[model samples]
Target: AGSSGSRGPSPLTIGMADTIPLAVAFHEIIHSYFRGTEESKCQVKMSGDMMLSFPTGIVGVLANNPNPAKLCFRLKNIHRLDNVLPNKQLISINTMMSTRDTTVVDFNMPALTALLRRQSEKNPTAQYFNVDILKYQIRPKAGAASCPFQLVAYWKCEQDHTDLKVDYKYNLHAMSPPSPLLNVSVCVPMNGEVKNVIAMPKNIWNGENEQALWRFTELSQHSDDRGVGSLRARFELDKGPSSKGTISAQFNCEGATLSGIEFELVGSGYRLSLVKRRFVSGKYICDSEVH
Candidate 1:
């Protein structure tokens, strides 16, 4: 690391030497983040030789930019960028388009409807949902650094003929390593008198808030789309005090109702109110008050 008259390693020279390795590392990190439990062990490691082979290709892409200032701005704003130089900038539009076809041939008993009716009769407390990801696509547009992704989810509600669906499209500029999400699903008994009361299963009701009607404890935690993406939250009678009634629940994903179920309470009645909704940095909605 020889220095010029400045007596320090040249920032420009170090940026050049470090850029290739940094980009390689970033690519490998993306793969690891998407790997699920079944594919946990699968990841491609980049070697120094492999990185060197793409030196010119990487630099060419960076240098050909029409505006150098834009490059610096992009580098600075990168979520994963570092202090020294803009984090390794790797913009490759690898177009990947795949279709998935699934036809559920449910050939059992008289029909799906009849079978579900009989099952519901036997287990009245059970909640049934036939969920499906109706449509999904990752479309790569020409010359765009980020790729556009579309997702649609649908489900059939047997209790009521409610066709739940969610349609959303977004562009992915960069992908980060998969981080675990604190997913919790809990169904606490609703206090009949109080509109909203915080009740802990193991202890007494300590606090009360508009969003504290029903408490939720994390049954499990996982990352976004890492594996078994959607979480199942259910409310049953045995754990709660009420005998049975009905609770109106409207589950919405990105402004679209994915699933809505009105539980027919046999003995007691309960209700849920969504209080505070916070949008994270990436526009991911986090419901703080799901009572």
Candidate 2:
């Protein structure tokens, strides 16, 4: 998710965040009969499975072994910003998972906010963004855990500029890379006409709608033979004073999941199946000023 805010003409601040949930449930027999087993075993299995899809194959465990412990995992290319408004400038992306079995289950997950903070401190580049994460947890019954995570990244810049640009980077080392279909729209102030718009590696252009569409059937992680996909644009100002406009984007990445958390049936003969989904959300508003 990504958003933008303008103090005068150009954007002064940009914000972005992505949230994904990792849920687990075992067969009824396992929950009832394996009650004496240490929760650490489950955590280890879930962590290992989740790391399989990560580019670096690494994740930080913020909390461990609570009745319902919370864990946060950072995703590189799974989630993206769909839309950006210069004046409104706010971004949010989310992926959720759950189980329908009526059986009582014990589970542990991540505290996304705490994990994000710890990640920033460890990475010099990320520290520059001043990112923030918000987390929410809900227990439907006595032993079930449900948590929702939100991460926000923000940057501040100058005010009187005329151009608008955004970039999206994919994790080149992911075990399974994502293929994203993207649609980007920029609203040019009536006072100024669009000068030029560009999408890296090039893409279809719609002058009538002031939009760009990109469909990456296959996107690979950064490597010696392959590179990440990104898009950017520039808007030129017209003769009149600054006016108001908007910039928005939308995209879907298939076969890419955020968390690698999973559950196994410890003592039951019943089979268990896993389902996953991923997507992005946000809008940005652009405003102009007269010099």
Candidate 3:
């Protein structure tokens, strides 16, 4: 699809025109897996990340175009990029940030023309493109965000009967779109082990001799069914009320960052495919001492 004008190379030119020699060679880059029968769409991977405490934390997003990418490309700028073409050249990376939609970064870097020619001539296949959009700090005392997540638990023990209940919720306000949490898990460290225990939702169970666990495929206000989630368990202890130990939990959520952001590129002649975004944490806890 060569046309009048500068005859410059551009992202919109990568695999966009069947008539172009380079575009015709890598026509398969846009496989069915990327998008059904329809090709010519830019495929990008997107995800969000949040690392912090109630007092302060960092949130960011990662976008990547996988390997087998010499023919493929990504956007440039902001985050660390590798194995991909420069934004104005052969590769492109989509950046993600955790600020509100109001304070997003601008993606207007000039010299974006004539990149495809060099990328195609030198390397036919290489690493994909990925960009980290925007990342910033959030101070609750400054009125940026309140509590990000919350957990409540109660444990009681009698001679032959022991009862435990836990309730959990995440502050939707912290997330712009209030995305749901993924791989959610709740655990309570206990003293003794017990079989034939009773779990309210049936998904909750006893683990080892010192812990009980409850897992959810996805946790959110809408997915909670009741607007909130509550898990309970009843079991008998071999020894009397020894100790309830400590309770710990962890989870990950993809989609939007704490800032609640969105992005777009204009006049690039490139069509950004569907974005894969997410937010995750290794270990997290909510208590009076920690927010």
Candidate 1 lDDT for residue 154: 32
All candidates: CA RMSD in angstroms? 26.7, 23.4, 15.6
- Candidate 3 C-alpha lDDT tens digits along 115-168: 322333354442222232323333221221233345555667776657877665
Residue by residue across 1-291, what tens digits does model 2's lDDT show? 111121111112221221212222111000110011131211101111121111111122222223222222223321221121111112122234322321112212333334443554586343122222212111111211100111111111223323333333343222122333233232232233444444444555555664545444433343223433334444333442324343333333333332322223322211222223332222322222212
- In order, candidate lDDTs are 0.21, 0.27, 0.40
Each candidate's TM vs. the true structure? 0.20, 0.32, 0.51
lDDT of 3 at 223: 73
Model 3 scores what on Cα lDDT? 0.40
Q: Any idea what lDDT model 1 has?
A: 0.21
Compared with the true structure, model 3 gives a TM-score of 0.51
Backbone clashes for every candidate come to 11, 21, 25
Off by over 4 Å in 1: 1-15, 19-191, 194-200, 203-291
Q: Top TM-score: which candidate number?
A: 3
lDDT of 1 by residue, 93-158 (tens): 112321122111111212322433444457554433121111211221222222112222332233
